[model samples]
Target: MRNRLVAGALCGTLAVAGFTGCGIPERSEVRVDGRRQPATESGAVNAWRKEPPPRSMSGTDPEEFVRNFLSAAAGEPDRAYYRVKQFIAQEDDHRLQEKQGSEVELTVVRLVDKPVITPDIDSTRVTIAVQQVGVLRTDGKLAPPVSTDTRYEFGLRSASPAGSVDDGAGFYVIDPPNVLLLSDVALRDYYESQTIYFWNSERTRLVPDLRYLPLTVPNERRLNEVVKWLVGGPSDWLRPGVVGLPDRTELINNATGGNGRWEVNLDMSGDDRTRADQLLTQIAWSLPEFDGQLELKVRNNSVLTEDLGERRSARALYQGLDAPVRYCVYEGSIHPLGIAGESPGAVPLDPGANRNVVSAGFTRADKQVFAALVTASAGRQRLSVGTGPAPVTTFTKGPEHTAIGRPVWLRATDPHQPQGLVVADGRLYRFDQNARMSQIVLNLPPGSVTAVAASLDGRRIALIAGGALYVAALNLDGGTVAVGPPRRVATSLTSLSAVDWGDEERLIVAGAAGRPAIYEISVDGALQTPLKDDTGARVTHLTAFPTNPATKLPSGAFMYEANNVSYRSSPVERIQREQVLDVTPPPTGVRPGSPSAPFFLF
Candidate 1:
């Protein structure tokens, strides 16, 4: 079906333009032609030349260059089609190309909606909607065009074509046998060649910026291979000031096999340089193998300058580490200084605390060092360590025991008594006082209570148990608890986890369900609109950043275990992906390699 459309379109162009067809040239013959062509005649040759070409021999302008190239390619109809397809494919501008085999057919469809272009003085951007219709023929005639609409923005570098050249300016069609055809190798080669042209062309004229093209060929296997190479290729190297807010970032340590661990560091710096500077120094490492066992560590310099500057400096210790640790130093010493640790558990920090916490994770005996440091820091009132169980003797105050069970979540309440909520044995327990037995406000059925969240005032709690939404209100003054009857939010939901207060009266909840949608629930139990309009893969987690009261845009949010994919909110504008830390370990059988390891160290 797609092939038929492409064939029809190509035949239509040939018939309408009265162009001749050319055969695919042999590789040897093509190479001969390429060699005979002076390097100076090549568009990209000038880009690498240190000296500019003689003004007299600058040759034709960009528009003329394009016309000439098209005309030359047209001499070989098959080659011309291949070149055109090659250029389109390289730019990933194809929305239609699907299957590839002999007699490749490509259907080019214009998008119903055009892109919105914001032009500058010398340059004007024109957005066109197009679909690449691709068809692979196994038998019979090509099928009808199967199109995928995509919008492409082309920047006219030298404004609209003017004077006698105006005919070739804007967009011009190279009469076929000169028009390029659609083919895998042809498109690839064409793009490779054209990229050179765009990069080096001496005359500034209408040329497609290959930089903005997407590699959209339909073959998943081929696409994956191409994408992998492109992402890591020289053409894709991270440029200064080009690192956008990553939707995700990942790091691997001991890639060779120290427990086969990796650390993903996120540049949450946003647009604020100062905030980014502070965030870069404080590294956060998550262990995917161990349920995202997050460890927060401070750079030695950041730590030393604030605490042990007189005895030792960070510059000294940092220089000793085999691998350089990434960090940014702030002007002032670390404020709210402290060292803290937790063993085999998630440590929830106060939202309002200063960003001066230093942490580390250790296996075996080193865990003791972390525990001792945390204990001493807590004793000195320098750090507040949130942990599950501290050995009674380790606590200088003989362990002011709070009967919170395993997987306990603590939130500071009034400083006098921190509130502890425990999910244990399929029941929810609230620990109020030091010696008092924990209160079982709600006894969840077996295999229920997947997640729990409290309102800002701690007066209400939301829980997901047995695939249902359960709300419980604590009557602090009345000394009573009212549990709302469980209500099914979505029957197909496999799991419900992330839940948070969206605002004073609304709760934002997300999870694995019919569709992973961020829902806004009012205090009165009205389900407002969802933040996401499309049904996506199950949402692993949802976190909201503090929103500026002035601007309603979300400041930050955490989306866990997200599938790395792209989506379009509209035809013209595509949301750019922000890089986040990639903490995930490599696949099995892939041996991890370390950045550095001394022969004797391992």
Candidate 2:
């Protein structure tokens, strides 16, 4: 459950780190006045409106000039510098203009305070506060409002026209502050976000490249902008794993959609002729958010594919980041659970088999099970990957830390033989049983890793280091996994002990729940809606049904010890007590009993 809508919930609508999975807005329809319009796209849900020209600052008050300047700053992305120049002194204009490339994008901002104007005989200094909403960076990323208290020093020249002794409307910029201040809010009434489609490296699936473009223009115009950005390619960060298959192909005109039909007019440039269906497929997939069919047109060209119906929707054609099963440690052994509620749901993994297995790892895609096994010969822990009663291949002979997080299986180029990732001694290891074992060095806080989880797409990985959550994009360098600078998942969370991907967008986390005693969190490190209040339960290990996304995670397998009994349940069903063995010993100050380590869907 997520927090309900409230004031100061400006960042609530901010897109989660990835638009490819759980954060993708479910299909929604829009109303154009009384009549219905196509399903509204993200960020573009604001009511359709003509982009009015920037207000004239020629004779306006200082506050009005400031207000108008904010519009100018964002109204044109390519001309942000000149627009800000309109509100700055001529002397300072050249500086802001030349440094435009370094400028950050800020569109929806609020005037935080009443302007404090101190008029002098020759000039005036007006100080004001501003907050911008949903900041759009020049690099094309969206973040919540920051630095709301930023003070912009604006130098005002009140040279009276005709020397009328009245400042009147003759006020212009004398000196202007260099930094822009802004805050973000839920402005579905004024803005919309859109998903630009791109092809995964395999060209088998289309991943989304999301952008928050201004809704100041008509929906079709905004769609044209989306198409252009799509053609340009994925963002700098997402480009490593995805390519724009339909990108580089020009749209002859703005795309138009209505009444379940969309028209995509193309220029047929740069291999467009050879890959027309690919372009149509990308368009079909991206546009179906409106529940519409696609009609592609190339000017003066004969009808190539007459029924350019939408070939796919990004959702259905795309099987998001998981296999369709879940595995749990029930009754001291690995067991399987149906993701879509399948048959033989809670069967013991290797019935009657004696093993030194502590925490087992099984991928949802297939039953290629791996576990942290105690090596009898060396008395050290190693990752073992196998199919049946006995281990076949060893992943690591660890000299690492004593505690290890559950390993995960990711789809490999071979599809049948997926690779694995695990954490030990605060270091990440990526290995294939038959191949190489390499350390995934990341620039993160130093400490033994308590938990690790990978996204279904194999593009990002999340880890808990020193009780804080960090996420990083994955890159393949030659033959090993490389992590980019990890992005801190900071929010209201404190003392995070365990984490798992609940869905594509959120993470199911446990710490010390809410203010009233509940513990749940999203991937962004914000509080999730509590499942149940005051169960007096402390979750030590958590796992989700991989097929049915754990977005709300109200139901899932978790082990919590209450009164010396380790009980594992779906958090909503009858509890089944398991023998207490070795719990990961909840990070120093906390106490609970359960051998329940991180479990997964096999």
TM accuracy, model 1: 0.27
The lowest-lDDT stretch of 10 consecutive residues in candidate 2 is: 11-20
The 0-to-1 C-alpha lDDT of every candidate, in the order given, reads: 0.27, 0.48
Worst 10 residues of 1 by lDDT: 1-10
Q: lDDT tens string, model 1, 286-341? A: 01012212221222112111221211222121111121011110111111111011
Q: TM-scores for all candidates?
A: 0.27, 0.62
Candidate 2 residues 196-295, lDDT tens each? 5666565655554445444455455544565666666665546666666443467675676655555667765555464666666666555444454556
Query: What C-alpha lDDT, on a 0 to 100 scale, does residue 434 get in candidate 1?
Result: 41
The alpha-carbon lDDT assigned to residue 112 of candidate 2 equals: 47
Per-residue lDDT, model 1, residue 277, is 31
> What is model 2's C-alpha RMSD?
9.0
| Winner by lDDT | 2
Candidate 2 C-alpha error for residue 159, in Å: 20
